[model samples]
Target: MRVQKIWGADIYRDGGSYGFCFDSDDGQWYEFFLKTRAFEPVSPESHQPPIIYRNGCNSGEVVLRLSWEEAQAFVAPLRYENRRFMELIDIVMTSGGTARRH
Candidate 1:
């Protein structure tokens, strides 16, 4: 499946994590979360890092995990949009809430 667009992205300073939302080719929208530490590689050959997503079962005890490669494929088509989201995040963070984007 391909990503149509990234609709939202945010860095949670208090939680020390990042989250993003995107639409897929199947006409479904997904929101996923990742920890800051996930960006660090466990080994040199580790390419498929994991990401976390809240489970929809309402149990508040489970999470769905996906690999980095899988996440990459999900956002490949809309890579530029993801990049823009990150850029906006950086600007907002560095500017101390003086800048905004929508």
Candidate 2:
């Protein structure tokens, strides 16, 4: 089945790369990866362009590249939730409360 939604808390970002988990229509979970690069202009009159690369995990840890638009669709929903969660964590920590593992 196709992926239906993504979980906000499962996303990880490191520099120009990102990874996230999603739930499919069949109720299965999977992870995806995205990496971006800024390419310099080829000539003095040109402007820099951004390149985004997307990938999905296959069986046995293999990752296959996907289109940028497809990857963005999967990740878009989680953006706000992810930021909100982090803000909540920050509030808790700053208020002298320690975050504990469940």
Cα-based TM-score, every candidate: 0.45, 0.38
The TM-score obtained by model 2 is 0.38
TM-score of 1: 0.45
For model 2, residues 1-102, the per-residue Cα lDDT tens digits are 365675643322432333455577766666554332223334331111212222343343533444434434433444335653343233223331222332
Model 1 residue 38 CA deviation (Å) reads: 10
Query: In candidate 1, which residue ranges exceed 4 Å CA deviation?
Result: 37-49, 52-64, 72-77, 81-84, 87-102
Write one digit per residue (lDDT tens) for candidate 1, span 70-98: 55454444444454366434432332121
Clashing pairs in 1: none
Would you list the C-alpha lDDT of every candidate in the order shown?
A: 0.46, 0.38
> Candidate 2 at 28: error in angstroms?
1.9
Best by TM-score: 1
**Candidate 1 least-lDDT 10 residues:** 91-100
Runs in model 2 deviating more than 4 A are 9-14, 36-64, 73-80, 84-102
